[model samples]
Every structure is written in structure tokens, then in C-alpha cells.
Target: MDSMGKYIRGYVRIRLESPAPERFFSLCVHNRIPLRNLTQEGSCYEMELSARDFLRLGRFRRKTNARIHILRKNGLPFFLHRAQKRKAFFLGILLGLVLLAICSFRIWDIQIAGNRYYTTPVLLETLSEWEISCGMAKRNVDCQKLMQKIRQTFPGIVWVSARLEGTCLIIDIKENDEIPQETPVKEDTRSCWDLTAPWDGTVVSIITRAGMPLVKPGDLCKKGDILVSGAVAILDNDSQIQRYEYVRSDADIVIETRFPYYDEFSRTITVKSYPGEQKTYPFFTLFGTDISWYHTPKNTSEIYRTERQLTLTPSFYLPVTVGEIITIPYEKKSYCYTPEEALELSQKHLQNFLKNLVSENAVILSRYIQIKLTANRCRSQGYITIQIPGSDKSAVTPKEFPDLSAETTE
Candidate 1:
């Protein structure tokens, strides 16, 4: 619009008080000078005129004996003049615009989704190998090439989609299962098997489902002894053995096993004395350079310090970060544990050991222990008895029992 053009060049509102106001107005119109919002205020005339048009008013004012005074000013020229006066502010605005342009054209973040078999770091490493990394120019990246590279590198990744979104490289992936699923094999279809004892243990209970029980409850079974047999003798109507049949041995056999435990630790202990106060220091980073007010002390052992970093995004962290460090001062002290204290500590350790065994499906039945505490060492020795279900199966085919061909009366 013409109004916009007038504002861009700058405009001013002026008042006219002249002996021949009609002659001044006629000269402006005849000269093709634009005047806007012309109004009469008693003995004076007011109007808006372009800054350039106002320049031509000097000659008209002299000829007509009129006085011109500016009442108000607006437009782009006035703004530029003000900006020029504050050099640092104007420079900062220019730098901000340049940074925005650079960031928009460069990649600052990368996102990957729908991946299970392949880890994020692994994919990123592959991208780095192909010259695709953060801060690269957007135009330098070939999305189709990247997709092909990913698919070739990992056969498990069946499909890949790569694209650019803003300053981030977004990758969507569809991965095939690392291990193929197969039909479940039936237990009875396996060759004849016999459940054997892996170590010496007393049988607490035995429940046979598909085999003959070789050992009963409260019987001692040594290592390599068959607890359940896969061979069963078939009988005729007269209760005489006719032939032998073999089956897949299966049973739930509980055994009570003894495990010796011995643990030792230093009696000397560490203690901490705190001042009950803390100090915090804040810091800021700009363009990878950090500006902080924190100072490190010579005796860092007496100080416990930690820091929390502030990030712009949850996944993609920028270099420009603001954070604070908190430090607490404390003193360390060492002392030896008493006999009673050592006993209590050793008891706690035993309970933890039992918990670990329980986590592995072993039931803690009972334990017997003795504690020995000295000036520099604490020792606990004991034997733990636990109940564990036996699962070890060994083949006991007909070849192993060729001598048992003699038939017996059932």
C-alpha cells in the first residue's frame, strides 16, 4: 500500500502558520507533494507529509512567509536511526539471526524408534561410519543411502525409514526377531532318559510321573546314581516278566544338600562426620565454553560434590547448558568393631547369602554357624542345608543294560 511506502521512507506531522496559507497549500499541490490528514486548528493548519516532501517546504515557507514546526514523527527511518545509536544491541540482533540460519540448515539432533534387537548406540555407530553424524549439513546427508546402509549392516533390521525433521534426523525401524521361534518338542517323544543325582544328597521327596522310582524318600543318593529309571519290566497274566519297556524319565525330586560357608572381613570400619550444611555454585555455558564461579579445594576427600545439568530437550542435549554444583564437607573416622557387633554383622551377611540362594530357587531349610572376632579380622564359618529340585537327566538306553536280559517273576 502507499501508506506502507510512506512509513518506510518516514513521515512527519507538521503545523503551518503563514500570512498566505492558501499560497503555501497551492504550491505543495502544484509541486505534486503528498499531504495527508489535513485539518484546520483555528489560526493554524496541520497535516501529515513525507519526510522528503517536508524538505521542499523550506523554499515554500520562505516565499509565503509561513512557519513549519514538526508535531510528530513515525516510520522505518526513525527506527534505523535509533538502532544505529546502540551499536552493541544492533550487533547482537544480527548475530542472533545468523545463528538461527546456521542451526536450521545443520543437524543438531538424531532420533531412532521401534528398535529392539539393535541398540541405539550401535545404530549411531553405523551412521558415524557412513559419514552421518550430528552437526552435519542437512544437504550433505543422503536419506536413501543411509537406509540402505542400515539394512545391509544389520540383517535383523528388516525395514528402515530415514528422514529429516527440522534440525533432527529421524529414523524409524522395523526389526526382525533375533531368534526364530520353532514348534515346541513333546517331552515323551525324546529318547529314554534317567534322572540322576549330580552330587551327594539325601532325598527329601520323590514324585515320578513317567519313570520308575529308583530311590525313595529319606534315602542317600551319591553322585552319578540314578534317582529315577526309564526301564520298566512288563509282566504277563501269571505275574512273570515278559519283556522290558523304556520311557522318557520325568520326576519332581527334592534333595537336601549341605553347603559349607565361610566369610571374613576387616574389623576396622569407616565413619563420617558431617557439618550439616552445603554450598551451591551455579554455572552457564556458551558455545561449548563454560563460565562458572565455583572453586575446587585442595582437600577434595573431605568434600562430597555432585552436579545436575539442565538440558533443552529430554533426548538431545545442546552445548549451551546451565547447571549448579552442590558440595558438602565431612570428616572421616575409622574404628574397630566389637565382638558383639561383629557377630551381628556376620548374622546379617548370612541372611543375605540365604536370600541369594532363595533367588536361585533353593529353599533354606536350616544352618549352623560360629562367629570369631579378632582385633583386625571378623570371620564367620558355617554349613547351610538347602532343599533344591533335581532336574539333571542322563540317557539310560537298552545298550547300557544288556546284562539285564534275564527275566524275573513279577
Candidate 2:
């Protein structure tokens, strides 16, 4: 409270020269006038007092026969009195305060939450159409109405809420959990599928869930061969076969397979060699339009790289972007590699090929690599044996199954 009073009422340093300066100080204390940093400088007493108290000190000075002189004036009231004489400075200050007040009521940022399948751009576009975008007045937004509109526009969103947080608008959304019913085959359909071998391999393990296993462990199978049957035979009262019902087959089948890869590398190749000559082009972008500040190269063979820098306010709001394009000229040059270099290149190519061939579920059982060197080239052959999961589903063709009743009657 004392600090605030000093700021509002201002304070002054005064030097008192009198025969009885101590009497003046004692009178100030008795009248409850605050004084700070009181000191005596050889017949002259110096102290600080509030501007209001300084005005009331006239009577005390006459009674104590003291001469008081203000050495300095400080605080907001004194500053404002000095500023009143400068018209332009005072106008600038007033305009700045008005601008700040206007910015406080305007929205400068919009944020989204709980969105996955929908993109932020799409949601922002929707909000823009609804007049809820950045720079709009917060008082104009109706949160409940906007939430309803969002839920209606995006049917996948089950719930939505909009609220204002300071100068930003926050939108939260929730999506529906139910799966869409547009699949080609429904889970509850009478038509069934069978699990078949996707490649030629030996079955190492089989786990059946809803169908009879057609291939057991250690059985060799070919591509398109059914590992589990979708049809189950029902038994009759007399222990004879009755009828068959189709069901979806579910199972896991692991198989052992061998994959062979071969790669070759040449001893001679063409490479691009860059010259020292280069050119740069700088530009600025406002909104989405680019304004170039320098000339760009027209050569078709020029290699270039672009670097962009976006200009943003202290709050991280982007309003403009700057970029530079650096172009370097190059020429094609023919280079020949040594035998050792050719061998390394061939091995690197084979390693990349093997990485692509291997899958996450594959377990490497054995691997072998053979390198051959000719006069101008090196060749690498890789053989890898692995155990991988091999379960797949293929649609059963109707023609593959004949009418059993007709065959029995014939």
C-alpha cells in the first residue's frame, strides 16, 4: 500500500536549511507525514517525502524557521505532468493503449483437440465458414450452436464442444467407435473362407480355431493349397454322414521357406561432379503468394536446394515466410572403381535386397553369400532359409466344387 501511494502521489527529495532542522522533522512525525532516508549534512537536513505531504510542510517550515528546497521529483504523477507538454508522445501512448484494448477482445489463435481421422485444416476451414476463425471477436461466437453444427457436419464425430480460452478458441471432438457397415463380406454372412498356403513351403506348426486342419505339422504344401477347410461334416443318428455346413476358417500356420537373391555391380559408373560456380535467389511470401527478390536461373541442368524461414510473432503466429534457393552447376564425369570397391558395392546391394526380403515374423534359420569377380564386374548371390507365418485367405471358386448330390445319383 505504501508503494502504491508513492507511485500515485509521487515523491520528492528536499534539503532543509534552518537553525532548528530537527524541530521540522519532529513536527512531521507528530503530524503522521511519512519521511524516508533522513540524514543531516552539516547544518542541512535531507529527506524524501510524498508530494501531498510536501504541500502540507509550508506551515512546519514557518514554525521551525527552515528553508526547504525540492532536489528531485519522481513517480507516476510527476512523469505524467512532464509528458503533458509533449503532444505527439502523449498521442502515441493513448493510441497504443487503445490498440491493446482492441487486441484483447479479438481472437488470435485457434486450437483443436481429440481429432484423429479428421485433419486440422478441414476443421479450421469449417470454423472459418462459420465465422469462428482467428481475428474474429470472441463475443460474436455462440459455442453451443457451433458444437451442434460441427456434430451435424461430421457424422463420424459423436460429440463436440467449443470454448474460448483467453484469446484462443479451443475445439474438442470425439469420434464414433462403431465400425461402418460397408465391407464387401460381413462377419455374420453364411459364405465362408478357408485359410490357404500363400507360398510353397513345409508346414512347421498349425493352430485351428473354427475349422478342421487339412495339413498337419511337417506336411509339405504348395501355394493355393487349403491349410484349413471351411466345410464341416455333420454325423447322423445311425453314425453315417448327414450334411455339411460352411464356416469361416480361422487359424495360424507357420512355414519354413527358402529365398534366393542375386545382385551384380559394375566396375565403371557415371557420376556428377560439381563446379565452383553457383547462384542464389531469395524471396518472400505473404499469405501463399511468392514474391522473388532476385533473378532465378533458367538452365535445365542446374541442381538446387531450397531453404525456407517463416516469420512469426512472439506468440508463434506466422504471418510471412522468407526463403532462398541455391543452385549449383555440375557436369557428368565417368569414373572407374577398383576391384575392392566393386566388391564392397556388390555386398551393399545384396544386404539391402535381403533386408527388403525379410519380414518381422520371419526367423532366419541359415544364410549364405557367395561373391564372384570377373574382369569388369562383381556378382553376389545370397541364399537365405527362414521360418515365417504363412496363413492367407483365397476366395473359393464355385467351379472348383462340383454338386455332390448329382454325382451320387449318377
The lDDT for every candidate, in the order shown, is 0.82, 0.78
* Model 1 per-residue lDDT tens digits across residues 1-410: 99899889999999999989989989999999978999999989999998888888889999999988899988999888887789998899899778776767877768899998789998898888888887788899999988988888898989999988777789999988667888765544256788899768899999999888989999998988999988887777967666668888889988899888999999898988775567787877665577888788444334433444433455433435577766677778898888888888888998898888898788988889888877899988989999988767887666233334565669
Candidate 2 lDDT, 323-372, residue by residue in tens: 77677767788888887788778777866766765645787788888888
Cα lDDT, model 1, residue 194 = 87
Q: Which stretch of 10 consecutive residues in model 1 shows the poorest summed lDDT?
A: 303-312
- Top TM-score hit: 1
lDDT of 2 at 128: 84
